[model samples]
Target: MSKEIRKFCHGAAVAAMVGLTALSASAEVSLNVATVDAAGTLRNLAGNRLHTLLREQDAGVQVRHIEGPVLGNAAQVRDQVAEGSVDIIGTDIAWAAPYSNFLKATSFSFVFRDQEHLAGVLDSAMMAELIDEIAAEQGVRILGAAVLPSRAFFTKVTPQRAADFEGLKIRSPQLDNWLESYKAIGANPTPVNWNEVFLALQTGLVDGAHGLPVDVQPNNWHKAAPNVTDLEDMFGVHVWMINETRWSGMSSADQATLVAAIDEVDAWMTATAEAESLSTIASLLDQGGGVFITHNAAKREAVAALAGADKVVAFPEDEREAMRNKALAAGKALEGQATWWAPGVLDELQSVR
Candidate 1:
């Protein structure tokens, strides 16, 4: 969480605490809101925002915030939500892919043009159908989703061309799509748990890691591998979901309140992400500890906008196009092998404006 959000959520929590305490004895709804990320992360802040909203919206409703991995990791917490052990959770949409493989499509790098494109598909009828299917099949209801910081390549050495990535070891989660994304670029994708990425990089266990600047900064991985390639290839979706049983048990008005609260959280998340993206890059450059590289024109423009274009290393245009072509081909091929998605689902997502 940024200072701005931390301050706002802190004040909101204080005010909400007073309001909820006044009605503590008579509160009607008690929700166990959980998130796996640490206190300063976007997902954690979303959980805080939800708690604050529920309290301010209804004095009769009480929300218990579990802000860290006290319960478990992302997959474990998501499972808890389905099992009703956790009332609500904020985590990666990809963690829910085991219940519905259609969600895997969203994890493919370069699959969506940008945040607006992803958000459009999230709100589209197709996504609604997918969510409803999950609710009925896996007993989880997705309330809303926010775009996570885009995953970029943070390496020890900057690659100036497509072939420069050949045989490079990139640490990644074991997700099939994500690993395949790195493999598609001719890079050797190694499945390393996120918690181990920093050590893995430090010890030369991997040549690079694919992740967000926010993650790199907080974990201080930049100190280990200071070269960053901002492919902006893929972005993760941080979803707010509730146990289907819990959702169904709620009064219709309470359900509406939950959804409305999440909508505001989502809006705040989108705005925060946009501003944070630029500031993170600026911070990285200001520290003079990392070399940031990108071939994307828009990303270059963004660096220029921040007046840090001089600090960004440019990847060759031809190499970028070649890499893009290969990545697209690989994404399409992976979709063909994954039979879980409804026929034509990928097409529908791509067609979304």
Candidate 2:
């Protein structure tokens, strides 16, 4: 062959290879993440970390975060994700019930002993299967559970006993069993959306609200209520989810990378959330603007008595037993798994006790 012809063929081969490589890289997937937390909060940490990890995994992959109520409340975000209007969302199980009745199982109060128990349950095969089943039905995918501590009641008035809650109106999301539980104790439970909670308290429309100290303190609920009662209620298990249609459209390699990124973000979120809740509570008390009250031992006993012998009678007999059994079984199955947080976060969670 002539020297000029040989050089021309070599250059064409190089150009073809470079073009294929560029095409493959450009095929990377992109997703949008939405959360209820505003700027500079631990709640945004999970989404932020996942976004970073996804980028690191694939240089071409992109994740855009929409924080605060930019996409409406958590419930609205979930609906948007389901309808494919949003690519991803972070929301709690309570919000999932609107999309799937099976999620009702995860809403059972006190079903988990602590964050570790809840983590174990989510990581279990049975729970994973259930989540997948629900996700398929709802047109979304459960990436994993975001770690948050148990919620407590913050009030302006100090309660000497459970009976002290009598006639006081408390703010809560509308959940029938939860309402019934509060009503059974003589307190009037009122449903209020998160956006309206601050006003509800400021106007004395509600005397108290239930939330994690870290969650409420960041918003300065202490300024409105001035008193917080560590009435350990339910642990909040928020799920990181993505629209199934968007997820299914991703390349297999990109999907694997995305899942791994979510796992790392979840671990970071769990550690940060638990630490922040405790630290915020201390900060609030130190500010001297609010008083932190421990539940009266006798009053706590009375509340437990009302809950019944199972220590989780807030639900019907069959339901309560089923939750306990599932949690215990999940704990046993995850006994030595490093991902399960051995000795359990249950011990660390007792600090709030």
lDDT of 1 by residue, 1-353 (tens): 22111111011111211212221233387889898777776777778887888788764456788977788777788889999999988777777667666677677766677777876666543455455566788998777777776777778887898998899999977677667778888899998866678899999999988776765566666778877787767886777778988776665555555666777888788778767876776676666466678877777778767746566788877887788788877766655454444445555556767
User: Looking at candidate 1, what is the lDDT of residue 190?
Assistant: 94
Among residues 3 or more apart in sequence or in different chains, the pairs in candidate 2 whose N, CA or C atoms overlap within 3 Å are none
TM-score between candidate 2 and the true structure: 0.72
**For candidate 2, lDDT tens digit of each residue in 102-193?**
34334444445556665554553344444445456888767666657767666788664555677889886776545644554457889987
- Which model scores highest in lDDT? 1
- Model 2 regions more than 4 Å off: 1-26, 56-60, 295-353
lDDT of 1 at 12: 11
CA lDDT of each prediction against the hidden true structure: 0.71, 0.59
List the RMSD of every prediction in angstroms: 8.2, 15.3
Model 1 TM: 0.85
Model 2 Cα shift for residue 272 (angstroms): 0.8
Per-model TM-score, in order, reads: 0.85, 0.72
Task: Give me the overall lDDT of model 1.
Answer: 0.71
